[model samples]
Target: MKPEDNMNIIFVGKRHEASRVLSLNGTVAFVLAVFVAALLIATAWGGYSIAVSQVEAREPSESELVAEWKRKLDEQKEELAVLQQNVQYQVDALTLRLGEIQGRLLRLDALGQRFVESGLVASDEFDFNEPAAVGGPEDSLSADSFAAPDLTRMIDELERKMQDREQQLRLLDQVSSRQKLEDELYLEGRPITWGWLSSPYGYRSDPFTGKRTWHGGVDLAGKEGSDIISVAGGVVSYADERHGYGNLVEVDHGDGLVTRYAHCKTIKVSVGDVIQKGQVLALMGSTGRSTGPHVHFEVIRNGKSENPETYIKRASR
Candidate 1:
């Protein structure tokens, strides 16, 4: 190599005690440059490898990622199933409630029909067999779906109908009770089922003493042991022997009205016994002051004896 082509390098010690000189030709310099470049490349490559290792430690592996995805899918499926079950339960409960309401409505209809048949209300006015008449102009905003809210509204409407029916039934009951009271209080008909009026009220000749006396009641003669019925519905007040009566039965109707059956062979009712009209009170016989099988029937109003013939002539209710 030529002297000019060779390069000189100098090295100095830290203490400046000694120095060294080196000479490099073109082939050697090229070799040294190549070695330095290879060292730098190796250092850079090592740094890049460390950075990739750190990133891999921070992130999850492929298996872990797949497991996490599977768990999330299972959880979502469970939530969906729970939601579906809840929706089904709600639907079933609403359907059951609707069925119960329908049953109640049917019972109300039956009751209303009975009231109508009993003549409490006019059949034309309250036709329980037919559905209620309802009509309206179709609204543009009408609902198309029978959702929970629509079901709730229908239940509310049914409850309102039930309230209306209950109110009507209460009124009918009141009317029926009043009519029953009137029928029990109004007195009519004869004391005996089969008999003839042998004696009347006012002046009559006494059979035992043959003397003219003011008779207070009428005498109905019948076959012995015939039933002596009550003329009205009342409670029995007396059913024992009296001064001129044997086996007597006295019934007190309401409103200060009463009836008496005397000279009975056998008393069939006791005191305080509530009885209906035409109920047997006793059996007719020749007892007490009676001369034959007869019943002394008398009606009293407000402590005054009334003419029994007037009540007997009234039409039966």
Candidate 2:
């Protein structure tokens, strides 16, 4: 084919003056085609650039990868250490609380023993030497591992319960102590274990002189040589013969109270002897000015003679 490097064109109009002609060159058209082809190649190469960027993004440097793994491992180790420390602290706190609970339980057991020995109660199940008997069915919900906050809450609740129990035990101990003291000091019993109230106190005709006179005590008639015992716990202040009061025994109970036993066959206790209630002080017999085997019992309060009938009547009930 021929090159056809030159081309022409014509335009005609109805009017003779409106005619025109146009022309084109082969070199200009060739240059334009070449420029268009180069632009298409460059656009295709930009896709290759995108592919290269994707390949570079897929491969990371060895140091950068090692640094990333190290950071993650360090974070994990730190978390594990913190968890271990927290667990250890909880264990230590629980151990201390357990010790305190054990001590309080020991004290409670000792107090219970004291009450038992003092005859305050018949028996108790809170024995110190024995472990508590406890058993129950297992529950799936409670079998899970304990969380830190849950364990701490449980320990605190137990501590509060133990403190409350301690307060109650102390109150019980105080009450028991007061009861023991009352049992020891309060006097309420007859002078003789077995006897009869023969002559009342206040007034009577004297057995020796047959004259109406004031009698300071009551006369208890019983078998000869019968035991004459104290009516209350006290210290013996006197135990000797007197002018008209035969072989006499006097006891000084605390709180300005005293007791006297006269006309005894034999004096058993002496001065300074610590005596208990119902302790044998002498033996009843006819001695000095007594007519027969009898004991003259006197209740003295604050160094003055009082009616013995009131004390004797009280002991009967």
Candidate 3:
């Protein structure tokens, strides 16, 4: 239909019909169409085969995938171990705290029991299981907030009180003992009491003298050989006859008190011998400067003479 389509060729070698003009346009177009169609079909089939082979060569299978999962499992296991260790630490901390609280409870219980014994507080007031009483905004806090080391402090207070009580008891015992000792001293240690003086020092009637006369000792009337007693606790100063006193006895009492027993029928104690109150010294007698048997007694304090009658009156009590 166009000028380009008019190009032609003749096939002359086969026969007279072949010697006709040949149309190249139609044959060429047809061959070109066939070549293009074949190239497109072959390219599409090759691309499809390449895509299928890539699919067949795809990544690992289930076994390898499971190995990877196991790796992740191991990591998680390690993480769990660390978490368990942390949990154990927390548990230890809580256990320690619980132990501390239990110790405080035991202490509180002991303190309560002791309080009941000492009559300081009631046992019911210190129950540990009950909620702590709140005295203020933060009174329910730890033990330090209320009663801490105050537990042992009460021991000191009680010790002081006990010492005071013991001291008072000792004082009472001492006073009672002193009173008893005083009674004994009054009864036994008195000089010249409840007894008559048979002789007095430095002048007295000699019963022989019938007339008033200067004498060295006064005669005292008593049954011959009666008991002659010491008036106080002391050592014997002399126990021998000298001049008018026959078988005389003398005692040196402390604090300058002295007594002489003259005309003793017999002497019982010697010099430097300790004697207690009411101890027998000799028998009563009137052996020296006497017309009849009698005893003589004398009391001199610090070399000053007092009436033996006065001393005898006091000793009677």
For model 3, residues 259-282, the per-residue Cα lDDT tens digits are 787877888898999886788888
On lDDT, the candidate that comes out on top is 1
Give the number of the best model, judged by TM-score.
1
| Model 3: colliding residue pairs | 9-22, 192-312, 193-315, 198-220, 198-295, 198-296, 199-296, 199-297, 285-294, 286-294
Q: Please give the CA lDDT of all the candidate structures.
A: 0.87, 0.83, 0.66
Among residues 3 or more apart in sequence or in different chains, the pairs in candidate 1 whose N, CA or C atoms overlap within 3 Å are none
TM-score of each: 0.63, 0.52, 0.39
What is the C-alpha local distance difference test score of candidate 2?
Answer: 0.83
Candidate 1: what lDDT?
0.87
Instruction: Give the winner by lDDT: 1 or 3.
Output: 1
lDDT tens digits, residues 167-229, model 1? 887787778767876776779888888989999999988888889998889999999999999
- Tell me how far the alpha carbon of residue 225 in candidate 1 is from the true structure, in angstroms, after superposition: 2.9
